[model samples]
Structures are given as C-alpha cells and as structure tokens.
Target: MIRDDHQAGPTLTSPRSNGARISLAHGGGGQLTDELIGGLVLPRLGNGLLNELLDSAVLPLDAQHRLALTIDAYVVTPWRFAGGDIGRLAVSGTVNDLSVAGAKPLGLALSMILAEGLPQRDLDVVLASVAQASSEAGVPVVTGDTKVVGHGQADGIYLITAGVGVVPTDRRLHPDSIKAGDALIINGPIGEHGLTVMLAREMPEIDSVLRSDVAPLNHLINRVMTRHGGGVHFMRDATRSGLAGLAADLAKQSGRHITLDEAVIPVRPEARHAADMLGLDPLEVANEGKVVIVADRNQADQIVATMREHELGKQACVIGWVGDDGDGICELNTLIGGRRIIQKPYGEQLPRIC
Candidate 1:
C-alpha cells in the first residue's frame, strides 16, 4: 500500500538505459524493459509517431482514416501447448495488439525463421494452426517470408507476425485520454497463460490440468468500442509482465495514482496455488487471453455489463480506480486492509513463458 502522505516527483515512467550490457530482463516487459526502450531504443529510432509507445503505432491515412500497426514474435520453448501453439499465439498476439488499440484488423504478415533439422511434420502442424487462427479472427495473411538458419544457430522455429488495422474515424483512444477517477476493468481471470506455460516446462511431472488462455480478442473489443466509444479511454492486453505491468504503464502514462483491490481481482484457484508453489506473484505473470480497460467512472458499470455479454468478457469486473497522484504510482489494497505500492517487476518471473 502506498502511504497517503507519500509524494513523488514528475519522473517519466519510461525506462532509461544505464550503459549496461543487455540481459534477458530487458525484454521481460517490466521496469527494466521500459528503460531499455525509453533510454536506448527510442533515442536511436524514435520519432513523433513512435514516441507515443502504444501497443500499435497509429498512422494517419487521411483526415478520416488511421492505420494501426503492431508486430509480435513467438519463441515459446515447446512451441505446442494445451490450449494453443506458437502459430496460434502469433496470430492472437498480433491481432490483440491491434484490437486493443481500437482498430479493426485487416490483415497480417507472417515471417518465419526455421532451424536446420526441424521436423517437417512439426512445421505442418504450426502452419495449420496459424492458418486456422487467422481465419477464425477474420484477418487474412497477406504477405510473408521464411528463412532457415544453420543447425545449432537457432531455436526449432520462431514466428514473427505483423498486423495492420483500420481505426474508426470517430475513435480516439490513448492513455492521454484517461484521467483520475477513471475506473479500471479486466476481462476474465489472470495468470492462466503464464502459469500454464511454466507448468508445462518447469513441472511437467505434475499432473494438474491448466491450459493457456490464448484467444483472439478483436470481436470483443470491437463490441465494446461500438457501444462505449470514447467512454473507454484506454485498453491493453495484459500479456508479458501481466496486469501489474499494464497497471504501472497506465499510471505512468496517465500520471495518475492507480489503486487496485486485491480481493476483487479474479484469479483461478489453480493458478493461485501454482503461483504460490512457484513463489511468484500472479499479478506479475503473463496473460494471453485477457484485457484491461480504463473507462469513465460514470460508465464503469455499464461497461462491465456490456463486457459480460461477450464470451471472452463473461468474467469482466471493475478492479480499481485512478487517484490523484503527482508521482504516477500504482497501489494495491491487500486482503488484510493494508495498502502497498505495486512496483513493476525488474524482469519477468519466468523467461520465455509467453
């Protein structure tokens, strides 16, 4: 819990580079990761459009049209999982990135890097999943390239997918649009995707059943946008670094104090226990099939009700509210009525769990 009297300066929440060599944590999507982007990457390649740092970069096509572009790469160790495979992850990940930006996905470009000695049968399965997921999301695969690496030089397979979508003429969603007193909502439980992947790799001996919650969320997001429009100010898919990461980013971007009630957040019992056993915080894990939304306080209830009408949002609930904080902090109210600061993790709990 953050102390009520605690005051902070107007420091940017973005990451800063410290001249240290890159580590896996830099890509973990946490505090250090943000620093790498803000300090190093952005300095070298950033421009006005890139500086916004939204999941997808929104580009203006004309006065009435805007394009959203986002790209994601998949390198999950096993490639195949209980609920989905890398192919599915590639599609869902890219599609969700565009969707969360309030865009209607038009198509995707798939690129593949294959290692020598990779099995043809495995490639078939992965490509099939990709095709199916693309069709299911109604986003066609428009263009792609494939490359092969020498043996021992690459993982079995790696997938890079880029997507393009069209933002509605009337929609203007960004963290800048959020303010204090706004309500935060999450669709469905958290940690399933991270826990599922961890269990499959670290504790395969265990027999507990848990599957990754990997699905395309464009339709659900479109539904909310259609009704709420500007009322829904910000949206993010809680992927790497989980809900905590999203919360911290939002707080910093909005420059507001974001507080969450731990008791009200939904987490599957299995995920909770699994996280406990693994000595990890479910909030800091990853999620592939969940979304976090920030909407006007007056419209929060209606937004939740509308979310519930969708299968993907059946478990949606308001999790917290924004507060006046000059320092851009995120706080969590625990079960014992204690409040504490929710610091973003320095790195992800598990590597390559996405």
Candidate 2:
C-alpha cells in the first residue's frame, strides 16, 4: 500500500543559505539533490521502505511473492535526441529501476503533460516509440492519464512513469549485502547518453558519432541473475550524476572504500574527446544503458565472460573493487600512477541531459 497523507510539510532551504527556495541543481541528481531528499523529503515522509532509498521499493505482497515499484519523471529538453526520445527514456528508465532491484517487470502506468501548442505529430511519434520500447522489454503500458497545460507551461511534453514488478522471495540485492572483497563490474562504456543529449541540445551543428545509449536492460540483467544469483550482492544503474556518483554513493552506503582502475574503465575515444572539448568529466556523465554490479570476487571473471556473450554486455569488464580500508571514500587509480578521490558532484555540471 502507498500513503499520500503525512502530517509534516516540506522544508525547503537554499544550499548556501537559510532562505527557502529551489534551484536547478537540486534536480541534477548531485549533492544538492541528495541534501534535498535527505533533509526535506525524508524528514516529512520517510518510512521503513522509503528509508531504504533503493532504485525501487520492495514490498512483500504475500507468502510467496514480493512487489517492486518505482516512479520517475522525464523533463529532458528537445524531447528527442540522437539515439532516443523522452518516451523511450521513460520506459527504459522505469524498467531498469525495477530490474536492478531483482524484479521481473509486470507493467507500467504512464502520464503525460502536454503544452497547448504541442504538435500532434510529435505526440504520435513519442507514443509509437514508447510502444516499441515496451514491446522490446516484454512489458505493457497498462494504463495512462493526460493533461494539457497553457502554451509554454510544459516543455512541449513531459512524461511520468510508474512501474510494478515481482521479485522472488529468495532474491536478495542491496548495498547492505556488499562486502570489502566484492568486485565492481559495469556492462559497457559510460558518458554516451549524457554527451549525446548535450551535443544534440547545444551544438547541433557539430556532427559527431555520439548517440544516447538508451535501451531496456531487463533481459541482460535477468540472464546474469539466473547464472550468478548467489554471487551478486548489489546493482545500480549509473544515471543522472553518472558512474562517479553511483560509486561514491555505494561506498558511503556500504561503509567501504571503492577503488576504480582508470585504465580498465571502458570509454570510447569519441566520447573522451567530446567530454574534454566540453570541459566535462566523462565519469560524471549520465548513462541509460549501463549498470554497476557488485559481486563475489571469485565469480567476477566468470560473470564478465558470461556478460560479454550478450549484446548489451559486449564490453563488460571489471572496473573496480571494494576495499577493506577507509570510511566511505572512493578513489581512482590514475593511468599515470597517481590517485584522486571521487566525490559526488556538488551541483549541476551538465543540466537536463537525462
């Protein structure tokens, strides 16, 4: 069951001051976003399930089954990008949230907010994309709602999706299960999705090969869980604030150090160049088609070999490992025999690239 009534009210405050206000950075999924959720949202509404703060909330439905639910809103500008649009993003994002939590997606509920001047052709195109993505993931859009707003009120279109899935009672995936000797593995390269969207929105004139890596990862994850369920301890998709953000959060939550090897982290040359040109760190860029997994050290090699057999996991490899020392610190071993600490980005670096 879900609750909409809470006695407490929202407590908003500027990141730098005592005054109450909201900033764009608050939605960037960085430090500000964390503060907003931890300080304000949690104080007013956090409960046993919500306090867990996993990608999706897992709830027991009966003696033999458990339910996982997740909701997300997409306000990505341009509505369309090189490899995907907002519709595909909404579906994939919601589905991935459930999958990482060890759930088999059941269905989705979609809600759309449309601007008055939005074109019907654009709406039809987006809906078609949504249907196609849902079919690819083997899930259905079971219900929906639509609302029209004044011209310019909505950014052409906005999508909100809620996904429900079933988790086997035996499956266990959470940060608390992570251990110092566990290995960190990622399915593929990072920075493609965020860089693609940024270039498409800002420098449409410059031709590049970058394309948003936006696709549902449920099948790929399901295969991994089937073979290595006993070894897998935790999983999280590197979204909004990117791989660095996710790694940092994992370290803090598990109370262990995370050390990443820069040489092994897969990054395409084109993506590296684009990031350097834009003065952005590729490690902090968002990705829609990637997930970070923590698994037993003994099973790491076999897991990578199995992952490489799938299309989505073609470049899968071990990028890091949990350490026995430090208090929630994440460090990167540089290619030049140097090291640096990784921190969650303080504020918005690349805005609206989600």
Q: What is the lDDT of every predicted structure here?
A: 0.86, 0.90
Model 2 misplaced stretches (Cα beyond 4 Å): 1-18
Residue pairs of candidate 2 with colliding backbone atoms = none
**Clashes, model 1:** 5
lDDT of 2 by residue, 307-341 (tens): 89999999999999999985888999999999999
Q: Write the per-residue lDDT of candidate 1 for residues 228-255, one digit (tens) a residue.
A: 8778988999999999888987887777
Residue 191 of model 1, lDDT score: 92
Error of 2 at 28 (Å): 0.8
**Model 2, residue 50: C-alpha shift (Å):** 1.0
lDDT of 2 at 269: 93
Q: Which 10-residue window of candidate 1 scores lowest in summed lDDT? A: 1-10
